[model samples]
Target: MATAAQKPLTGAKVFLMLVAFFGLVIGVNVTMMKLAIATLPGTEVDSAYSASLAYEKEIMAAREQAARKWQVEARIQRQGDGGAVVQLEARDANGRPMTGLTFKGTLERPIDKRADLPVELSEVGIGIYRGSASAVAPGQWDLVIEADARGQRMFQSRNRVILN
Candidate 1:
């Protein structure tokens, strides 16, 4: 039988036991936190990169849809006189004519100092726009055409027109 003189657990031993239990709990908590962080997706550079990739895909899809919905074609030929004729054909995806579309054309000659011409398209027929004025002494002129249709902007292939 234990005697009354036998002291209870000393203060030093109780303090040491408490410290050990707290240290073990802290260690386990830290380990769990590390594992969670490793498995979860972080809001850092990787997240930003993924978002940008999605945005680029959306933009590309919109561009392709616009191209298929609207069609713009151009032709340049010599007139009976010394002037030139510039004709444009605009159509929808279904090959139907698109009418009442605004058109703008610019003829630029970088080599020549005074050869820049800008003209508005005239309505000729269904989905057809024509320019009456001839290019001024055209030599490697860049012909630009712009149009607005269905809330989308359509442009023609930059044609290098040669006036002979």
Candidate 2:
């Protein structure tokens, strides 16, 4: 009976195997890295150092805002045209309508900063502000409401909302 001769393992073959293994590992790592970078949502603050430096100021502002006891209600409704409408009502602790303020609303996607939509609201009636954002995708969003009076921020609030 005759048997077929088997090929012997050589240094060159071992080197090729090692190179192929490492190549595959490197390829997968690069692809994963690309995906991660593409999907990465940048930091909330532009500069963490700067934000930290102003943390005390932010806290003070928040305290002042709380002291004012402003009642700011915000609603985001999805329109049939794939857009969204923002309605806001502001009042003081005494139930007086908050007027003479500039209202701004932002619809921010919880996961992607790039999907943030800014709405410039105008007072449709005293204390009632209305605005709209075009082409808003339906999903979970953070509604950031801010009211400014005399060129200074008077009230700020963030609320989570779901849109169908």
Candidate 3:
């Protein structure tokens, strides 16, 4: 008897083999993409940190420049009548009178609410603005001055004066 001829590989077998091979290749490609991305350097992260540092420096410089532009020198002089006169010496960046600037003063006694006094800008000198109010008692007083110059609130200072 003649032996049965071995069947040739079918088309379905060849197609399945091709599908499996392509599937494995696709999986390997996906894995390599993930690894490449994971190993990449984070240049954007470093740039963001550097940008924040630059912004902080810019803000600090702006604040410093504003402080330098609008400055106030204040003092309290003892009047001859046992009262203290609060003086605010206002100056611009070039040490000139910031004219047409409004000034407000609040004098509060350390112990008495009845002695709270408010004064406005009454005298404007060459480079000074003066506001005078009588002190009721001889003790510490809080002098709060607010100034507006060139549409900017440039000066706000609190000073303690001892009436002796």
Candidate 4:
């Protein structure tokens, strides 16, 4: 029996194969780089030096805040339109309602800081604050609540919350 011979391998075929392989590799690398850059969250602090300098002050402030023994509670409820309703209650060490405080609430995304939403809370009842934020996507979030009195921060708390 006679058999036909296969075509000889040529330099052009080898070069083309190499080019196609490298092109695919480079294309995938470029796509991955773009995704990484787009999803990256910038530095937590603008300047490391400034943050370091304020570390001591932050510690002192935290100690003072803890010493106050303020009882603060925060609640978040998911809305129908991808928003959230925020409610907060505060009390002093003696269980009396903490009054005359300005409250600010923030819903921070765990992975993406850009998705953070700030809620402007207002006092409806004494020590009872309520606010809402629009365009809040559902998922895990860090609820940060801060209370201020006389232009000074008096209480602060951070809690993890899930919105379905």
Candidate 5:
């Protein structure tokens, strides 16, 4: 007896398979996108163009600052409690300790907006300044140190620190 002719796969079946595969891929992509948006902090800058516009002026100011040749060294260490301390030493190009300068500092958590801490350093000695913050969580943090000598000498530096 002769068997009936069998029908091969049709175009509709192939098209449906392609659609399902792509639909799965698209579904996964959307899920990941949602999770990223929900967990991560958004917006590094409110106005990039404005910042770029000031780039030239900032460069000039930096050059003016560099001409003074002030050296600033910064350090961060953990305290006995759940806090951290920052120390800074400033010197002129002549390697003499800097004195009688106004200093400011800040500690910022990169991911948490509310974890910002203002630093107030007291001069322990000439060119030596130190400050402490309480209730600092154990993680990586950003530090900005600034020192100004009247209206003349200006110095600013940024560094990253970790607390345990």
Candidate 6:
């Protein structure tokens, strides 16, 4: 059988291929970065320098907190109406139910800051506290809690719960 000779590759074809490949790569990278930045809510502190300035104080406070040996346990539950409630219990290191502490929490979607829900908890019985939030769409939620005694911070805890 006789066959026609194949044509040599042209510079324009190679350049076009390179352009398409690089264009796809760059496009995908840009899209991913945008999605990451948009979804990852950032910065626990507004000013990093200010936080660093107080770093020692924070460290000391953490040390003191640890020395106190207070323990806090938190739980999130789904209510029948589709809303959610947070239940918390506090105890001393020796395992006694702690009392006379004030509690506050926030219900937030990790990816969306606009859905943040602030909850003020009330002590129901002894060291047990209960707080509720309005119905939230089913997804992963972050619960940040702080417990205070007198006018000082006693303990802090975070929990992630999936409602669904």
* Candidate 4 Cα misplacement greater than 4 A, ranges: none
Strongest candidate by TM-score = 2
Q: Model 3 segments beyond 4 Å from truth?
A: 1-68, 150-152
Listed per candidate, the RMSD to the true structure in angstroms reads: 21.1, 1.4, 22.0, 1.6, 4.8, 4.2
For all predicted structures, in order, the TM-scores are 0.52, 0.93, 0.51, 0.91, 0.69, 0.69
Q: Give the top-scoring candidate (lDDT).
A: 2
lDDT of 6 at 127: 87
lDDT of 2: 0.91
lDDT of 3: 0.73
Clashes of each: 0, 0, 0, 0, 0, 0
TM-score of 5: 0.69
Candidate 3 residue-wise lDDT, 48-125, digit = tens: 778987988667755864767866787767777755666677778887766677888887765555577786555568
Q: Which residue pairs clash within candidate 6?
A: none
lDDT of 1 by residue, 102-150 (tens): 7878776655434667756787998888884554674677787877667
Q: How well does candidate 4 score on lDDT at residue 111?
A: 86
What does candidate 6's lDDT look like per residue over 47-156, in tens digits?
A: 99998999998788889889989878888888888888888988899989988898999987787777888887999999899999887678898899988888998777
Q: Write the per-residue lDDT of candidate 5 for residues 110-149, one digit (tens) a residue.
A: 8875678998998999889999888888888889787766
Candidate 3 worst ten-residue window by lDDT: 39-48
Off by over 4 Å in 6: 1-44
lDDT string, candidate 2, 1-164, tens digits: 99899999999999999999999999999999999999999988999999999999989999999999988888778899998899988889999988889988899998999999999899999989999999888789999988888999888889998888
- Number of the candidate with higher TM-score, 2 or 4: 2
TM-score of 3: 0.51
For lDDT, candidate 2 versus 3, the one ahead is: 2
Arrange candidates by TM-score, descending. Answer: 2, 4, 6, 5, 1, 3
